[model samples]
Target: MADTQFSLVPKVINGGIAGIVGVTCVFPIDLVKTRLQNQQPGPNGQLMYKNFRDCLVQTFKKEKFFGMYRGSGVNLLLITPEKAIKLVGNDFFRYHLKQEGKKLSLTREMIAGSSAGACQIIVTTPMELLKIQLQDAGRTATVEGSKAAAVKPPKISATSIAMQLIKEKGITGIYKGCAATALRDITFSAIYFPLFAHLNSLGKRKEGSHEAVFYVSFISGLAAGCVASFSVNPLDVVKTRLQTLTKGSSDKTYTSWMHCFRSTLKHEGVLAFFKGAGCRIMVIAPLFGIAQTVYYVGIAEYILGIKK
Candidate 1:
């Protein structure tokens, strides 16, 4: 009887729930992305963000707890659309691929994830720029020993920052880092969804068991967390630079995506690509994964009556 009633609509609902929960829960990592991307290396020639502890402490002392969550509003705006694209797109790709008899392997999942990621980039880029500028207010450039200790940044609020951006650059200015932003959404989705599906498959249990589904979700969440970070780290750095650069730019410096990438790489060392990876793993990935897993499993059971 249950087999007769199973359908794709409930699967989509569960997927949407998972996407929303994942993005919302891991939002702190989004802030972390802003901080890492916007980081200007200290005078000591060392990397700015050593990890989560350093970034967190610095943000509290310099920017404040509220400061860390700079573009939270923008995030809320991006989540629904991004999540929809990520979940629905991935599943759609999976369905088509299966029709072609593609093996449900990690590689196949990555391809589906990559496609979904690319799709979400269009929806997510502008909001991502808003997030970046909000978080970059009075961001410190030097964190070397005494200099790091002595620096007290200018006071600013999200509203003030928004106004400041408008006055300085205009609507386009607020979205200055859009290309990079697109890159982030696309890259993460590409890595996250596929890895998640793979892990869930790994953790599959006997039919009609809530405990089994929960465990599968948990493992899948962990894999998605780790894989998403790797695929999207470089794009994240570029996104941060594009959005966060204010005083440093000439008229044309922030003009295009190519310009942003080349300039950031030229000025900051190659190592800049990996600025906040550890913190992201600790904060963003795990939180997002857990949220995603719960949403996926919970939504399905809710709609389908525990798959009895």
Candidate 2:
């Protein structure tokens, strides 16, 4: 049976609230994941962070605890719309794809997910660019060594960054990594939704029990997110690099997504693609856990007093 029938407004509200909560809970791990993904080995084959723990320790030591949340304001702000489009759009498309009383085929589910992922890119690109810029700021400073410390860091408001990007490269600057973002997100959603659905179905609870649905949703989302996030880590790495803004350099790094892929593989080897796999799994697992639980629980419907 279908889990629930939600109107468009309720779907959006549910998605937005779930996204905010999930992202807020996992932003720190996300920051670390980005930093890990963005780092390449030096001539001596040394990495800035040996592993996730090292990255966490060094980031906190250098940038402080609050620094872990550097780009979270913009992320939290944009994630609402981004996730609303993703979750609601998924259901919207799934509704159309479903034949009455028949479960959606795996292919149909994947198509629905891909559509949702593609739809969110319009908002995701700019939001991600801003967030990556902020999250990678400390890494850039660390790379620059003492010289970076001499110069003060830019203030951390999303408005200031948006204004600066517009001034520097016009509106197009905000969408610096659109291609990579679309590629990663599309692949991720394609994998995530279908897998989550299958897993959730395997562990289905009694019909109309919200509590059972909530717990099952959390477990399924967590499992699906870890697998999907790891599978797409290479694409995610390329996206992070493309979105990140470097200091005083107007030039693009690695040309295009294909170029970025080729360069990373050639230079850093296959293992480089999974640089932040652990941290990414951690971030995504909990993120989807919280998000899916909240979404399934129908808190938005309850708060808004819309009957299911």
User: Highest lDDT among the candidates is held by which one?
Assistant: 2
lDDT of 1 at 148: 45
lDDT of 2 by residue, 1-308 (tens): 55556488888889999999999999999999988888876556666678888888878877787888999989999999998999888889998899888979999999999999999999999998888888888776776565225333456677887899899999987888899999999999999999988888777675755335677889999999999999999999888887777742322377788998898888778997888889999999999989988887888789889867
Best by TM-score: 2
Q: The CA-based lDDT of model 2 is what?
A: 0.85
Report every candidate's CA lDDT: 0.63, 0.85
Model 1 bad stretches (over 4 Å): 1-20, 42-51, 62-64, 100-108, 138-178, 182-184, 209-212, 245-255, 300-308
Candidate 2 displacement at residue 19 in angstroms: 0.6
Task: Name the lDDT value of residue 9 in candidate 2.
Answer: 83
Candidate 1 per-residue lDDT, tens place, 78-160, comes to: 66666667677777776665533346666766778778777776666666655665555545433322434635445554567
Count clashing residue pairs in model 1.
3
**Candidate 2, which segments miss by more than 4 Å at Cα?**
2-6, 147-156, 204-212, 247-252
- Measured against the true structure, the TM-scores of the candidates, in listed sequence, are 0.74, 0.92
Worst 10 residues of 2 by lDDT: 146-155
Q: Clash number for every model?
A: 3, 0
- Model 2 has a clash total of 0
